[model samples]
Target: MAFSADELRVLRRALATALNPAPLQGEDVQDCLRLAEAVDDAVREAGRLRAFLLADLARYREALPGSLPGYLELLQDALAAGYDPAVDDLAALRALRANPRAAVLLDRCQVLAERSVRARLARVTQTAVATTPRPRVRLLALPGGRAADEPKPTPAPPPAERPVPKPSEVFPPRRRPVPPPPPEERAAG
Candidate 1:
């Protein structure tokens, strides 16, 4: 989010005081509080605006081909705000494919739908993995328990311990190998 100059100034002063451990003036504290409230208000307004936009989109979707303009506008705005298109939106776009814009939107929405599904699947996989019991990792030595099942990460050997990779292996080959200079040229050389 872009911060205004005033907000940025307040933020800078607050951070400076935080790091330097200097006592803040009453006015500085007030400014920081005001900035926090402004940030909270902006967040709330964003949520409300998104909710309203979603409601309007649903209404327009129900109105079908008749409210195409408003539907498309709201859908585009929602998409810009990271709203995942619903199945209904996909269906509506497909049905309205006679409109060139709707056809294009259908393609875009299809891509978004696939991405959303993949994200959801990834989340579910992560959640499943997280929920399955893992050996508790302890930072400090546990009093009497067995060590964690996960092996401790081994530290990398010092630079001198192993030979460094050649530059070609470290970096990708920048150019394709010259074609063997042809068999006749090789023999001549």
Candidate 2:
């Protein structure tokens, strides 16, 4: 959610009040409530914007592979809305590389995709260390309260570790070529 500087300041003050409970004046209470409502409104607006952008991206992604009218324009709009190109997008762009417009779109998608990945990496690096490992707590019942027929707790099996594929294996340079049409079918067509 996007917040103005004033809103953020108000939010910080509200949080401080919450963390340290004190008798607040009626004016302060009303201000805090108003700020909370404003924050909620901002959050809802952001959510709506996000949903619209995602739907737009999906529409372009689906249309790009077809010979639909305005698909190219749709692609440009999607890129502007922060669409992350997938492998399919790359392949489609490659196929359409002969078209100058497609080439421009391809270059834009490549740059956007690289920037997107870098931004994600930056966020991950910044917040990764902030996550503290949660302490595992075991609950025990009252002493001498064991049931005679109660089954013993079984240990969980360790998770199997799958080997990570190399980037080359994961993302091949090209898809397998389409097989040639059969001679009989080709002649009929």
Candidate 3:
């Protein structure tokens, strides 16, 4: 059963008091803990019930035919049941049919979903762009106050100096460095 607003409010107040208290009677403390656990269990059960209903609805839609009248009736029922037909009912219908009407509904649902996604993506893109630093586009004033699009002046390179030799390059060259003379010294060359 759904929790009434008054009951939820009372529970919230009790939880807040329990959480903030320095001490309480053992019975009161136990009651608070028990109530909290019950609330959690109730929420879990509600979620499970919702999921079961959705699955059953999907199965029902899949088993139903896709004529215009039938589709309209299904849409009406779904709406009356507080389901979003575009997002929820249409997907179930798509899984059920190869008919033209089913294909149309599927296409419509996809378009709706795409538009919703695009809107969300646009908002995120806008937010990201707003947060990023934009490159400064400076206009150079030429002689006689004419603005010119000259290439940006690159910073001068550091004064050139002789490159230091790497460790390997600095080392003495070994023409075919003896192959580590052999474990046994050959008879005096």
Candidate 4:
């Protein structure tokens, strides 16, 4: 963006007018308009450059762990140059974090990945609700084959309840014979 002598003169005059707040001559007005257009073009060019760098950064990110030579270096350089990380960049970096060799990028990738998820979640929450159809409800009948017009049969009466017997009535105690102490004691007696 090397400005020629004529363009530099015009820019200086434009700046002077902007700072001093003076009414501009016809030529000065033209120069100011040209400078404004140049500023806009510069802004657009900067945006394009950022887009290019971000795209390149994403490509490098995708080639991670087993990336080609200089891929990581390029990615880091892009980060240093303020290239914004895209969702895909964060995802690729997250995938790479599982590699032992990717330890250096793990924390950075994790933070960016978390931010990406939050951003996506915010976007989804802002969208209209999903368009799934509401389910229809219908009546369900019992398994009995009786017709609706027929008289219902009465249910059978329950059996009489039986009383529980005492534990002694259920089981009788058994009698056992007593054994003598010892043969020596019996001989002494």
Candidate 5:
């Protein structure tokens, strides 16, 4: 992503053109358009790579304690890449928390998850305010003022009818006690 001096000069000229229209050679305009397209392509490629990384991480997680080493490595790489931890990721880390690395990642992932959730809630709030219809309140006038009959305003739905879940409900306790596979079946398994 490092830009050469020539590219920097072109970028500066392009930005100046944006602020104030000026006659420019066709070559300069073409360069700016090409740069913009290149940036867009880079963004799309990054998104695809991130999606692949997340799917691979999920696969590794499903493999459980056996995939511990790879999963931890991938998780750290993902965190560095600004990946937000989903519930499954948090659960996986919690299950593996006995490993010191997993414990640290669990704490990190929890913070990332909380921040991601808060960001989403904020976006939803903004969208709701911008797009949701406001309930119309009917006004009734006293005898001194002129009044006209109007339909009653519909009530707003009860806010968030479902209760917020407790932490335990969101993240259940770790592994259940299960008898190890009987010796007779271990080899077959």
Candidate 6:
């Protein structure tokens, strides 16, 4: 598909960014690899989509009208031409010649990109879940640890009889009684 000079420049920039190498630390090797894989997949998918959009835009452009059909058409053309719709923030490009068709195309492209990203993320998430290790907990049962199941120790029986007190000790000796105090002191003093 033929693209305008501006469209070609945008596509070149996008490809450069996509291919650029990102610096990685030792600890980040695995993460970096995952990211690189994901990015590679995304780039491939985006390239395919870009080609398709470009073809559609070419067909639409061949039937271009004198005035703007809508903003959606312009946005579709820009995306089809490989201009990263995500990077284009200024509405001016979308509103070129005040076409509403461009805006609609931008919305559609945004939805498509979001769906693609979600699908990729789901795949990685499922893979991570499958590869993750489960934690193990061990339970040990020791012999004689439980009171109910363990044999009880036999207790010695008490002595046959307690010692009995002797009769002499029970009925001790008796002493002579002392005389009473003086009779007058004894009488209710």
Number of backbone collisions per candidate, in order? 0, 0, 0, 0, 0, 14
Candidate 3 lDDT score at position 2: 64
Clashing pairs in 1: none
In candidate 2, the residue pairs with backbone N, CA or C atoms under 3 Å apart (3 or more residues apart, or in different chains) clash, namely none
Model 4 clash pairs are none
lDDT of each: 0.92, 0.77, 0.65, 0.71, 0.90, 0.60
Model 2 accuracy (lDDT, Cα): 0.77
**Which digits, one per residue and each the tens of the lDDT, describe model 3 over residues 40-70?**
9998986786566666556656566544455
- Model 6 RMSD vs true structure: 24.7
Better of 1 and 2 by lDDT: 1
Query: C-alpha displacement of 167 in model 6, angstroms?
Result: 64
- TM-scores for all candidates: the values are 0.67, 0.43, 0.40, 0.44, 0.66, 0.28
Question: Which runs in model 4 stand beyond 4 Å of their true positions?
Answer: 1-9, 97-102, 109-189
For model 4, how does the per-residue alpha-carbon lDDT over 31-57 read when each residue is reduced to its tens digit? 878877887898899789877877776
The candidate maximizing lDDT is 1
Q: lDDT at 62 for candidate 1?
A: 98
User: Model 6's lDDT to the true fold?
Assistant: 0.60
* Ranking 4 against 5 by TM-score, winner: 5
Cα deviation of 110, candidate 3, in Å: 9.3
Please, what are the lDDT tens digits per residue for candidate 6 over residues 26-71? 6455544555566677789878887776565445444544334543
| C-alpha-based local distance difference test score of model 4 | 0.71
Q: What is the clash tally of candidate 6?
A: 14
Lowest lDDT sum, 10 consecutive residues, model 5, at 143-152
lDDT of 1 by residue, 92-155 (tens): 9999999999999999999999999999999999999999998987777864455576667899
TM for candidate 5 is 0.66
